[model samples]
Target: MTDNSAERRREKQPRTGAEQPWEPEDLVISEGKDPTPERLEEARRRLADEGPSAIERSAP
Candidate 1:
């Protein structure tokens, strides 16, 4: 029989960014801390317009 435990060791671990993926703060469009109201509005506007196109857009 094959040694399956070796394969278990090679399993990929899930990424854990500081914030959970669904948090509102995670979607900030501002450069850094203390985002202005305009920046927040712009971020929200872009999200409303873009939808799924904004998510995980990078190619394989």
Candidate 2:
């Protein structure tokens, strides 16, 4: 039979550390974060108005 004790031991070992969660301070619109609804609307408006110039009328 194949030996499996090492694998079990490895699984039993305690974790060296836990990963810290990312927490950006500016997770709001007032702080000038990107990807807001305002940014999307502006992009659509630009596409309709400008008609595809590889650029847009507005972006965040």
Candidate 3:
């Protein structure tokens, strides 16, 4: 059997808060597609209004 305690610890660790403010790049509109200016602006607004949770809500 393999010792997997370290991996488990990493997985169980709470996520750290954002070190920097959200940027347009942080908004992933799609996997491979690039975001348009309008989408980026929308994301920016959402980030301002909703905080980090906007990222998850923006993408599919």
- Writing each residue's lDDT as its tens digit, candidate 1 over 1-60 gives 889886787565543332233222334532344556765676566556665343333111
Q: Residue by residue across 1-60, what tens digits does model 2's lDDT show?
A: 999999999899764321222122222232355756766565456445554331311112
TM-score of candidate 1 versus the correct structure, residues matched by position:
0.38
- Global CA lDDT computed for model 3: 0.66
Q: Model 1 segments beyond 4 Å from truth?
A: 1-24, 29-33, 55-60
- lDDT: the better of candidates 1 and 2: 1
Deviation from native of the Cα of residue 41 in model 3, angstroms: 0.7
lDDT of 2: 0.44
Please give the distance, in angstroms, between residue 31's alpha carbon in candidate 3 and its true position after superposition: 6.2
Q: Could you tell me which 10 consecutive residues in candidate 3 have the lowest summed lDDT?
A: 24-33
Model 2: residues with Cα > 4 Å off, grouped in runs = 1-33, 54-60
Assess candidate 2 and give its TM-score to the true structure. Answer: 0.33
Decide which is better by TM-score, 2 or 3.
Answer: 3
Clashes of each: 0, 0, 0
Give the lowest summed-lDDT range of ten residues in model 1.
16-25
lDDT over C-alpha atoms for residue 24 of model 1: 29
Q: Model 1 shows how many backbone clashes?
A: 0
